[model samples]
Target: MNLIPAYPEIFLLIATSAILLIDMFVSDAKRNITYVLSLVALAGAAALSFYSFEAGAVTYTFNNMFVSDPMSHLLKLFTYLGTAITLVYSRQYIVSRGMANGGALGGEFYSLSLFSVLGQMVMISGTSFLSIYLGLELMSLALYALVALRRNDAVSTEAAMKYFILGALSSGFLLYGMSMLYGATGSLDVNAVAKAAVSGTIKPTVLVFGIVFVVAGLAFKLGVVPFHMWVPDVYHGAPTPVTLLLGAAPKLATFAICVRLLVEGLLPLAIDWQQMLTVLAVLSLIIGNVTAIAQSNLKRMLAYSTISHMGFVLLGLLSGVVGQSSNGAVGAYGSALFYSITYVLTTLGSFGVIILLSRSGFEADKLEDLKGLNQRSPWYAFVMLMLMFSLAGVPPMVGFYAKLTVLQAVLNAGQVWLAILAVMASLVGGFYYLRVVKLMYFDAPVDNSPIVASGDLRFTLTLNGIAMLALGIVPGGLMAACETAIGQSIGHALKNLASIAA
Candidate 1:
């Protein structure tokens, strides 16, 4: 099998091992070396991904178990960036918490993060059930370790146990579904499964059942209603940087798997899965929004908020491929992709502010922790204001555009009622986000000390905030890029499938 398409993953694997080895040897005083090396690794991987994308070719390797296309390339690059930013934002927070180096949980945070990213990359490029499951395990295992990093914290240990048990259940669901599909199709390759599905030899009852289990598994990973028991508790209990790691890039990888399994491997079952998604989406929107109003912790609030936002992503996803209209389906799926990326961007920035506000011996997790943030540091407060507004889907913010595009896709699918429901849920969700803004600007300072941060943290956060506004004002570039990427990747897969059938 040609390994050229996997250069990035291979490089990252080597670098992660090296960093882990180096971190073990370096003195605590020189721990910064590990951080720098981790960033350098991510940069190298990102550069490799960029060059792969620039080659303007779709490639499959390892017996076609892994494929590199525009979508994988784009998502992998963002995964690298998101992980790098998480490292930057968490550097101080983890260091302060003694989770960075020479501390209780220090030895593995950065290394684990890199492994998680590596798994995400594998998931993104995965073209077979085997490859996807391998990646999922790698990512999930690392996250499990990270969650329980603070061995002293009972809450953290509890959260890790819950996450691990629930995560294993989800993986079992996925595997069961995949097994059923393989039995029906006699292959694990996604395209081959699609071919078998279309040839009409597979049992209809078996196909539907397989899809049901698969959708169930995807819903859990996405942390939607019904299967989202772990999101809030885990988000609240984990260290903030670990929380960031959990909350961000992994979603993109999950979204990719959804597309791969549902859209690519099981297109014939779209009507069935789409209806299932509709139910999950509506429940997530209503429950996630309403429950978040009762939360006092900022991380838990974002956790429920995450549930609702995922519903919006599902709206875009379920809206695709009505009656085989390729162009319209591309727009619908692209909208979902766009929503996923922007949501991750906003998540990273929001968590960055939390990490920034925190100091040693203090955790800024409570809603009250943000009281009068404007008085302490107006710039970060403003940065935070933008992030909150974006999450709330306010005007001239990237989030509004993300929501609009998804709603547009929903409407295009003749699902006006679903679109209306999403809008209502968004309005309800806006309350908690606005409460955050109110807490920052209207309340008295809880602590008046200035927000001290590393130069990289301050500079990166500024650019991130600006990006929220700039991308909103000029969303065409990013939107077009997403659309093009989806079109090239999915369309190429379709063409290849047609030719194979011929």
Candidate 2:
């Protein structure tokens, strides 16, 4: 087995353990050590993942259970970068709230985040359902504890409970789906399953049933409606930094899993799955957009917005299956991948601002908190405006392109009705997003509300906000890179599946 491809994960594992040990011995005054260590580890991981690209074509090791392909590697690169950014954005928030002070403070959160990153790394590269499941559990288990970190808060406790219970139920759905697919095909490998399904040898009823269960599990993680009950409460209750992490990294990993399972493994059954996901997608669009208009809490509103975005992403996935064009699959997959990256970055930027606005004894989650934001801090207000516009899918912003790419891909797939529905929902969703922009610029401040953030927080918060503009304006380079990654993965997956089938 070639061990070089695994270097990124190995480095993180060792570094995470070291951080944990340091936490046990480090004092509150010296807790900053954990942050420094985490940055080192994350930087190392990022470098390693980048290095793999130059080595040659993507390859799977360990009997093809895990593959280090361009797509997975690219996502991991963003995952590490996003993780590092979150750490930087989180330091002041964590320290101020004593999230870095107590016995479990400083190092513990960083360590768990590193562990979660490791799981995400594994998840993106997984070539088998078994591997993905293990990675999912590792990531989910750490997150459960992270949500409940503020033990004294009843809301935190309840959020943790809801997350844990719902997460377990979803995991069960995923596992059962894997079992049914495995039983029908007698293979645990995704490529093998795809080949089997495509061969038309399996019972139709069993295949459809398994696909439904699997998509349900994926929908839960992606925060789509019907499976999205946990998102708002969790976002509202968890530490703001945790909300940042939750909104950003794991969603990327889940998107990878969805692409791998649906586009790669179930390509042969595309016709059936596409109809099912279309319904789910439309439902998410309607529910997420309509409900968000009524939310007073920023977190809850963003949570619903996430659900709507998931719907858009599903449109891209469904398009890949239905399109007649040869490049349709590649376009859909690339669009979805790019959408996820932008989504994570924008979420980080938005949450970073929330983190800065937040202080001890202030939740900073209500829309009223954003009133008169421009007058208090023009720079922060400007940043928030950019993110809100991006989320609203306005032009020249990354979010617009993200939605456009998917819609284009969906149209290429001939799913014009689904594409139209998405556009309508985007218009409706645009209303709520614009409301935030209006509050920041037009509304008078409620008495006693002011915007304040620490130095490091401010610096990163600005950069995160500007990134949406930068990428949106110069999206060609990133879009090209995304296209290349998805193309390579799909080509290899098809070749491998064909070889196995013959």
Off by over 4 Å in 2: 103-105, 323-326, 447-451, 493-502
**Residue 485 lDDT (model 2):** 89
Over 387-486, each residue of candidate 2 has an lDDT whose tens digit, in order, gives 9999999988899999999999987887788788899999999999999999989999774456566677788888888899999999988888888888
Which lDDT tens digits does candidate 1 get at residues 233-283? Answer: 999998888899999999999999998888888776677899999999999
Off by over 4 Å in 1: 104-107, 492-502
Top candidate on TM-score is 1
Error of 2 at 124 (Å): 0.6
Query: What value does the lDDT take at residue 277 in candidate 1?
Result: 96
Residue-level lDDT for 92 in candidate 2: 77
- Clashing residue pairs, candidate 1? none
Which residue pairs show collisions in model 2? 100-106, 323-413
- Best by lDDT, which number? 1
User: For residue 221, what is the lDDT in candidate 1?
Assistant: 95
